[model samples]
Target: MKPGLFVAGFILLFGHCTSSLVPKKLTDADGLVIRTGTSAGMCVGYCVFDYVLNGTNLTLTQRPNSVQSNLTTKTCQSTISQSDLNDLLGTVDLATFFKQPAVLGCPDCADGGAEYVELQLGEQKHRVTFQYGQTIPGSEALVDKLRTHRVALNECK
Candidate 1:
């Protein structure tokens, strides 16, 4: 067998194995609430964000130092379509997401920034925290979408 053909054959054979290894998609999203937010330690003026998601309603609350007289907490409300919510839920692999540790990396280390994504189902809950701008392995699509939504909400006039 030619060397190139041998390599290609090997790849094709193993690549097929990964098909079954794909994470399972979440099946039930009725009681699911996904919360995500970001915070910075050494920053001023609205350095903290708290996002809460319930059904199609999304609420974002931003705050700076309470002691600082110039900045105050701001709350914003937004609604996402059910279709959009379904799309976001479909990107999550609940099995893999729940398996992740409570803290993935050094979140907020060195005063850079920190972010967290949490899932609540019924009475069970799981949360993963990582450095800001870092992407989780299995839930990349969901996280990216949420981050974009947060940005849009913050930028809203």
Candidate 2:
């Protein structure tokens, strides 16, 4: 074999051997919390929503215009099935998800709206904020699941 060919082969083999030394993030459902919310700067009637998922329990808190005396914050309780929870968890690509920046696109600009998703796995916490209707490139599956859950929660009333 040529000298250059032998050197290149050795480097490739060495790199492959050492690649396993890096740690990888694991997705553990225990103590995992997923939260999604939306807000609009200029709106009326439940302009803000906060949804929290812990295990199979899901809670939603709705906030309206604070200045309006007639509008009051509301809280609702709901439970998601274990299968549904598993499905949601399965959509998470930890490798891609964790690498995303904290914020994406301009959020809540010009009162268009803003949406955010936060995930907590044990001690690790990550949050991504993006334009109201836009989906993060790497997290589309997870976000789609979350959006479905959010819609279900909104129809709880």
Best candidate according to lDDT:
2
Residue 132: error of model 1 in Å?
Answer: 0.4
Please give the distance, in angstroms, between residue 61's alpha carbon in candidate 1 and its true position after superposition: 0.9
* Model 1 poorest 10 in a row by lDDT: 19-28
Q: What is the lDDT of every predicted structure here?
A: 0.81, 0.82
RMSD of each: 9.9, 6.3
| Candidate 1 per-residue C-alpha lDDT over 33-124 given as tens digits, one digit per residue, 9 for 90 to 100 | 88999988888778889898888889998888555669768888998888778787888777778889888779888787999999887666
Point out where model 1 deviates above 4 Å: 1-29, 66-70, 155-157
Give candidate 2's TM-score. 0.77
**Candidate 2, clashing residue pairs?**
none
Model 2 misplaced regions, further than 4 Å: 1-29, 65-69
- Residue 77 CA displacement from its true place in model 1, Å: 0.7
| Model 2: per-residue Cα lDDT at residue 89 | 83
